[model samples]
Target: MEKSGLAEFKVEIVESCLVQPCLPDSPRSTLYLSNLDNQPLVRMAFNTLLVYEACENVLPHPAKTIREALSKVLVYYYPLAGRLRKKEDGKLQVECTGEGVLFVEAMVDNSLSVLGDLDQLKPSFKQLLFRFPFDNALEDVHPMVLQVNHFTCGGFVVAVSFNHCVCDGRGVSHFLKSLGEMVRGHVKPSLEPIWDRELLKPRNILVHDLVSNEEKIECKPHSWTPPVYKESIQMSLILDFETLKYVKDGIMPKCFDICTTFEIVAALIWQARTKVLEIPHTESVSISFAVDVRRSFSPPLPNGYNGNCIVAACAKAIVQDVITQPLSYLVNIIKKTKMSLTNKYIRSIIDTDQFPLDVHSNQANIILTDWRWLGFSDVDFGSGSPVNICPMHWNENGINASNGFIFLHSPERKDNGIKVIMWMPSQEFNLFEIEIESIIRKYVIKGSKF
Candidate 1:
């Protein structure tokens, strides 16, 4: 199973689907960014591209085929563009180029040993991916950055960088599924893409009237920041469903029958992280989650409508208080925060005139994103689907914090439990490991074979 062999297969798939007949040009469209505040909107416009490979029979071929497949995929996304505008009332509106979209690639390297231990791979991949340099290449024709020389031992890595405004995780998954279909010989996508940007139009020209018009926006004049930490961060342990459920159930007694896996785990992590970081009680920390708004669209976005359909929900608390609080309290905080996510909130965040540019940057230390319910395992790329599909990094907008976590459902595992993937600074991670193991040991009960 050499990289070249896999490369050949990749080429065959791309040629049969893309190169032979040439892809049809996507319709011209534009996204209106003027509605969105500068910093968060720009952050939303950038996306991450991921490459997954089996340790056995790594792709073998001239990097050309892989690169070609990438180019072809971009062709499919090209028609999508974004627009930034301010209305007469100074309301910011984000309009998508419904005609098409754009994407960027993020790359990383892994080892056979890392794959052998899923837990280690999870965090290691995240840390490596956050260091990806796509933003530095924003001015390039492709607006894509390559993360080469990642995942070096007993395997190879694939890099992808995409524009954030074009799509969210679900939308990106749709595109990947389409790419897999093309690779597997589906000339016509089973799921036809739906591109009606008009549907996303805001009802009022001035959506969020509360945001002050005088707030100033700020952003890094340039993309590309040095890695947050110099030391290499390795993946930790994988918490199986049985263990996770045990912990969740144990905490449920305190939560009064209301709490999601995300809230509980988030509380646990936040507590541990604050302790490890040794932050003062007065320090404010928050947990930001991404909320998909496709369902909120007037008619609900069509099944294959690919573009950004997400918003952020932040739950803030004092550093010391969050750590000492009961799981139930944290659950309530999360629920209340989620309830506040509305079209108005989305518009408010997008309305640069209302919200200050610094709002997005002043978020909490811990960020959580849940893909457990996203049904990623159903994404079959023709080769028996993925046993696992985890995000390689957390660099997307609000989630790219030094301490970030993503929740994923293991492919077809009967345990019905979710896997928690976390990344943090090496020192913080070590402290986290100690706290997590202690919590599990104290609160979790082992289950039958799962």
Candidate 2:
């Protein structure tokens, strides 16, 4: 049975087919992916949701225009139309088959209001995105897939799923911007697509080992099995600029250099989460995140360079120290670890044979990533910019066992501050909330709430 009121909704697919490139003579050869792209951490596919509200001028052809625009955009991002194949050495490469991507046209049973607030959403997998009919290996999968679901109120949602071997967050954002330009009647993308994947290949130099041995053992890139839990929930922590300013100002006097918003917030969460978990005092706790290395290059890679250009940045401390020390201590540790990611550090990780995946299976670890400045808000297809953009949490058959924190930039809804989305076991959520609130009150003000 469906939920009552605005929450009751359903999606039905009206059409599904392949959307090929408009150009006939796309490149027909194999393309080598970088070590960063081939690493075990980003070996799977991920999905993102872009929500658009009703617009009188663009209501009639929401799916038609996007389908046409995708065809044109694929001409430039040709690799996305191809498939991935694993080489003899176990590294994956693009086959450049130009087979095309899956595009689905769907319709919703109700208006956009049926979904309620996008900023604070629960997990729902009612076929908003296209799922492959048959199970297949990564090589047999389509490089990219998209679904556009039209609502009764003239609003629609664009859900995209793509393999990580082709591009990272920045690279995909660039592609969406180009596609949006095409939807608005631009013949060509504003920026030409660049596939210089070879530039990110590791140099033939001795690898610099920065991470500790404990991290290597814990974060080793191997097949992962999701841990079974009684129940889990998704929660959001909204910190506007004013709240952030107050928190940072209260703590800056005790730190070395002024800590960044990410650094401070990440540290706060790590502390709060660890306290709630009740881990042993002697055990080690780790926080891992991706650091963009695009600018770290001597001659920076062009804005259009579409490939993985980030490396794992990890910081670790004992549980006792983390729980007992001041928040500024963890902030300093994160700052130092992130600052250590120089061009040399990036090259060393790439050049090495075994680059460890930062996400450890250990229960005491925290994985955080920042998607606040990926240029998603600027993407306007014909109606206008999307009213909301967020990662869709789907747990069909428990295939998606992602347990981590994502930092989102909600300028309109969050008063130009940041929103942190967290997934964790329900049993500990109340305690975690209490811990976070206490920390905020202790540091920011007597009665402030996060």
Candidate 3:
């Protein structure tokens, strides 16, 4: 059993296999990866999505069933099986020789109940259940890797890691749902992926205002695990739809603006996070959030065309400016930033041909990720809906702790509010909760004043 301060569980790898696509595109050719696929962090950031499926009657044997299904799903996703290679012009492309995905079979000699609630898993607890266990060698550079953990009580966990450059969250969903279809004995994936990277290639002459060379946001290295520990001290706050409407209503009259849930959430959390950092009032605070450009394309990225179709937008202002001004003030900044993410903005980002890095604002910087209603609950791998679907928390060491971030989770079926996952030093835990709740409470008690 591997142990951390939080929990203990024994994980043993049963087998490792390279599951290639059942059929590669005829007359193998190198796939041209577009600029959307060439972002620097795309290869650097390994996205880990953990799916906790509860106990089921006569659970399917995972090793045999999953491997068979995954093989079939890869038929359409064969590019993932190939390794990422750099071309002569410094662009990244898929070598499509169909080397295959690294699939691991593992067993957890424990039950899901013992793991407790899926939402509150700490780093140590997470490490135990989902093991990719690669040594960071050149050989370990895979576009995708999956680990299936079978529990003693018949429930299981699935962890999928993918290079952000090759695909985005939505693409992962398409692939997984396809795998599920195969596991359930379907002949084909319900959603067939359309791979036409040529369609997304950038223009000959680039034009973008937000991410030009001189205006770019500077980035710095920080700890993924802030000085704070992601223990039970890490908790969640639920802002129901009703409360959201109330809060939006409150901000409207005071800030004189209509606000979406995302704008409201980002504005609220940005100020609260700034306060937590305890930076000087005059210090500048920044907040950046991801925008999906799937619909921004002229004809739109084909249905199920999930690659890295994102460009980050940010609002930067002095700490006092963000907090003391009406909530509308901060909301406007965020809204303007979003508005700037036009098709030209994305084209300018692609023109950079590097990670369109969000320039880091030194103090109390926050990255808000909205993952609500992504429809992961609909992905059933032979069982019904998963009890929980969580991305690995950003608490790992070396992701700048100073610049705070939030990944907003989808509201559960039984719940009307959003669930958020955040990581920072445990010492600031109380301060953050108080700040967020205080804002929510103020609006709760005193209705929006016209």
lDDT of each: 0.50, 0.77, 0.67
Name the runs in model 2 displaced over 4 angstroms: 1-6, 119-126, 133-135, 206-228, 393-396, 399-402, 411-415, 446-450
lDDT ranking from best candidate downward: 2, 3, 1
Candidate 3's C-alpha runs over 4 A off are 1-6, 24-27, 52-58, 88-90, 119-139, 206-235, 254-257, 352-363, 393-404, 408-415, 447-450
Q: Candidate 3's error at 231, in angstroms?
A: 11
201: Cα error in model 2, Å: 2.0
Q: Write the per-residue lDDT of candidate 3 for residues 15-114, one digit (tens) a residue.
A: 8889988875622668788887776534554444444555553346876788988888888888878877777787777777788888988887677655
The candidate scoring highest on lDDT is 2
Ranking by TM-score: 2, 3, 1
Count of clashing residue pairs in every prediction:
48, 0, 17
Against the hidden true structure, what lDDT does model 3 obtain? 0.67
- Residue-by-residue lDDT tens digits, candidate 2, 1-450: 112124656788899988888889989999999888988777766678888998775657788999999999999999998889989989899987888989999998888877664543443444677755435777668878899999998899898887777888888788889999998999899988889888987777665664432222232332333346765655666667777677787778778897999998898889998888777676777898888888998778887899987777788887788998888888888888888777666666677746665585665688888987777877888777888777765454543333588898753663588877776665666677788888777766745433
My TM-score estimates for the predictions, one after another, are 0.67, 0.91, 0.86
State the lDDT of candidate 1 residue by residue for 1-450, as single tens digits.
001111111101121111211344444433443322233533533333233445443444313334444444545544333233345654434333332222222223334334442443333343322243445533322223333223444233433344554455676566656655655556555676654544554455655355332212232232322245643332434466667677666667666456766676777777776667665566666667777777764456678776566666667776556777665676777777776666556556554333332334542456677776554555543334455454554443423445557776643472565566665556766777798777667665555211
